[model samples]
Target: MKAPRAVIFVSLFLLTFQSKAQTKFDHSIWDQILLLNVTKDGKVNYGGFMKDSSQLYEYFTLLSQNPPTEQWSKEEKLAYWINAYNAYTIKLVIDSYPISSIKDIKDPWNKKFFKINGEWYSLNDLEHKILRKMNDPRIHFAINCASFSCPVVWNRAYTGANVESALENQTKKFINDPLRNTITEDVVSVSKIFSWYKKDFKIDGKNVVDFINKYATTKIINQSKKGYKTYDWSLNE
Candidate 1:
């Protein structure tokens, strides 16, 4: 005795609704965590994060349960992975709190400290294997390495709807930030990020200067001298 057609239709409708709801991963927990522990200048309070570690744990569980799928939009994938990368970096720091730098943890980036969809992943896998493969260089700015010279973590969570603008803003802010780069028409001393991942910034056959000029307020001349500043690996806190 099969169920009535109306019953089958209603059951299907309910299932679809639940699926859609679950697919829209919430970032409110991560957002609140950032608001409470990160400064507007992007400095992190590891002590504060450690004190509020439960929320961070909850947020990590949410990320693990809602790993990106092919059904997700490009922006959705970008936002999810970027947030996971930053939040997990904070977790790494606080778990080993009192360290002067993330490098103090042996094989920090290689440690598989988190999971997404039941698969374990290390920071290097997330950054190099996943995010970099996404083909958007602005991610270099969005994902923080918990260091002084790395781009500061934005004090807000990114949503798929807002990620594009957020990436644009982060890139521009990092370039114009005098502490990160000194731009002049004749010469520029920029972050080692540019030197390390120069290939990522050279878009459409253009050179790295072309990419820098896209965001740098003081545009570098075509023939400007270029040099990389020493990266400060100290904790942002």
Candidate 2:
């Protein structure tokens, strides 16, 4: 009798704990990245680019600690890491305050700017190790590098449930802006993101032209003669 009762108690405890965890956050945790906008004339002001790396880190750590016992058809871990990488990238820039560009950070050829669960890694590691491992291409839209060339920073937190839609919206918004995308009568120019993640697009049944045409404001779908514009790696500050 005692043994049976003890087993039931443990099961109930586990259920309660799982219930609490599930209720924690329907959405991904987010910290605002404070954007200090500086004008060419030397005027500077906070432009609402707040991002919370701590919240992102803590969430991913939880996912890392316990591989979800529940059946998860959606990508929680991969999406979380993507958000973490982007958030941390911003934090890295803010840590150095007044950086001219993300590349300004001196990452040794051997050591890039990425780390997993506390280990040092390069930006390559985050995309290749975590994101690519998940086999998802939408991630290209979610991870901003704090550069003029990178995707615009989203205002909302990306939760497991909404990450898919969030990324779709992000993709559409990013590729249509003339500042981000340039098209002329003869040639079409796109952001460097398409170049960096060219494989991600091609692997997912898309080419440079195929990818941009989905979001290009113009009805033209010119696959040939497509060119990548020179990127402004300068910081968005």
Candidate 3:
């Protein structure tokens, strides 16, 4: 039997409202925590964070309890998972403070610790199962692994409203930052991130170098030498 036209219209309106609400997630708590803990140069003060661990746990609890629903926009979901990955990473480090590297933990990325939407997730699940599947190479720049060679941890929380701009800024910042990528007229040296996720950057028939040149201030001429910087697993502290 066909539903009434009024009922159908009301249902559509409710669905639209729910989608908008999902996109309006509050990231202020995460933003405040990041501002206090992450430095301008992207180094984290694990010591300082340990002192205010309560706030960190609060953010984690908030995330686990309020996982994004299907009604949320793509950007909203992406921002949420990215924040979750970074936040959980910080928690893992603080849980084992005074540690030298994330690798020091036994399979840290695979450790199932995050509960979202009633399912427990590992860091790998967040990255591979969710973020990577989103098909945005810029995500590599946005999600920090808490290591020296990894992308700098941004000092602000990523919100659905700001995620697009935030990602573009991060991509530009990372590509131009000499510490992350060295681009010149001849050779182009990049972080191992490019090499590790080579497939992600291949968009519209562009290779890795092509992708880098897009954001790199200094354009590569010949693209002769491409070297991957040694990934420093030492804590970003």
Candidate 4:
């Protein structure tokens, strides 16, 4: 009897743990994001984006409608908040209709732009505190700030499965483009991103050039050019 009872207890514990693990995330909407329009200029045209503001209002409703006492895994939390930030930022831009920059949609001092996970939050807080703090640097390029200086929006949506690879490609492509980097045998100059986020690229005793070199085109690596150009941030309109 004791042996049979022990087996039952073990079985029950394993089932409970599996349920907890699988329940950490709800990924049903991942496909919807991937389906949204992403353009080569890295613009999220979000055709009818203004009309889509209603969608965001509904999504935010889901997050705040429930208060979860159940602890979510870090990956689950990061993915949810990042998506929320991007969605809300885009909504903010479209809501104003003729906005020139994302800055135009936000408060100067950085206050609540929307409610998320039951808390009022700002784009600045979400990017700096949640994403960067989580060590996911690729997000810098993936989230569009409605500026031409920002990374080109890719053609696909960000899904949980491809999130890491998508971010890597964005960083590499943005850093290596001639518009973003200047390469020479003796010296190299690149976007302020190279300087500002050096830690992200310094994975193995490498600086920005070393990082860009991995994806730099032949012309870029030869350093046969005079100089690199700055990206015009005048809204991608």
Candidate 5:
């Protein structure tokens, strides 16, 4: 015996409503937090954060308690995890305030400080298990590791609505920023991000140089030299 027509309609309405609610993850909180603590050049004011750590904790708590549901779009999920990863990295730095580098904490990436969806996650787990698995090589430029060599943290948050443009802009910025990547006419010196995650950049058979050239204003030629810059592990402050 099938359910009544009214019962079926009510069930459908409830399901749609639940899906909409679950997908409505607000990232404005993160935007406000970033605007307050981050500078125009992406430098984080940990000293200011030390005074008001409650907002950071609140953001983390929000992420922990409300993991994105399957109803969320791919862009939404990607933006959420990228923000989470960067936010947690900031938390780690703040927790160990006055440290010279993120490396100052033993196995910083492996520490299980992030609780999400009833499971604990470390920075490494989130980056490798989730973000990387998303198959978007551009993520390497979006998730900052709180190091000088890491991609510059955008002054604003990554919202699903703007994530695509944000990622594109950041990739271009990182490639063009002389401090992070130097693209000369004959030589392309780049951050270790490309060397470390070479395979990720090789999606669709594109090599590291091909990937870099996509955003490099100088446009590396076929025979141009490639060199990896020494990674600076010092705090990005």
Candidate 6:
């Protein structure tokens, strides 16, 4: 009788632990990895991430095992997808380490290499099919493409509670970042992302200039000459 009682106790403990683990997706591992490898200015240390690749693998395992479910809140789901996109992009670069540019890999964004809940996906799926469909233009700044011209990868993980603010902060940071966008009272020279996804910024009858002014430190005149800077494809390491 005592043996049976001990077995029941052990089983219950394991069940409880599993339940708690599945309740909320844990991003602490990824968060720690970012903190250790990424700079505040958004420069990544691929060598550092390579050395700590085991932790990245562990984080991916957790994400694959617990893909978002219907029970998750909208914010929770969005945050998960955003983090997954950025993290996997990092993994891609590290896997192809020593490459001068992500562009070196043919069809890099379209190559399906990661898995979630037993389903395969590529960066294009995450950026276009899922995230872009979500209808938040600020997402462009939150997801990094491992290029010098792309938005800096945040050094922190996005949690459901922080996703909204993070989006806002990232948009403002990227827009005002002189290196990324040159916004002035007379002219607006910005990233090619603005041209690529121009429709996304023109939400609610507003134009791209209006959207830039929303976060830009210096507002561009409506008639100001808008030009796109030449995109640098060098790896952001």
Go through the candidates in order and give each one's C-alpha lDDT. Answer: 0.91, 0.62, 0.88, 0.61, 0.88, 0.90
Winning candidate number (TM-score) = 1
TM-score of each: 0.94, 0.73, 0.90, 0.71, 0.93, 0.89
Give the per-residue Cα lDDT of candidate 1 at 200: 95
- Global local distance difference test of model 2: 0.62
Tens digits of per-residue lDDT for model 1, 1-237: 999999999999999998767556689999999999999999999999999899999999999988887767888889999999999999899888899999999999999988888999999999999999999999999999999999999999999889999999999999999899988766678999988998998889998888988888898875448888889999998
Give per-model CA RMSD: 1.5, 5.2, 3.2, 4.7, 2.0, 4.1
Of 4 and 5, the candidate ranking higher by TM-score: 5
- lDDT tens per residue, model 5, 1-237: 999999999999999998788885777778887888889888988887766678778887889888878888999999999999998998889888899999999899999986897798999998999999999999999998999899889979898899999999999998999998887876667888887898999878778888888888888784447788999999988
Clashing pairs in 3: none
lDDT of 6: 0.90
Worst 10 residues of 5 by lDDT: 217-226
**Candidates ranked by lDDT:** 1, 6, 3, 5, 2, 4
lDDT of 4: 0.61
Which lDDT tens digits does candidate 3 get at residues 55-138? 888888889888888778898888998899999999888888889999988899999976876898899999999899999999
Q: Give the Cα error of residue 117 in candidate 6, in Å.
A: 1.0
Residue 84's lDDT in candidate 5: 94
Cα-based lDDT at residue 190, candidate 3: 85
Cα error, candidate 2, residue 43 (Å) = 14
Q: In lDDT terms, how accurate is model 1? A: 0.91
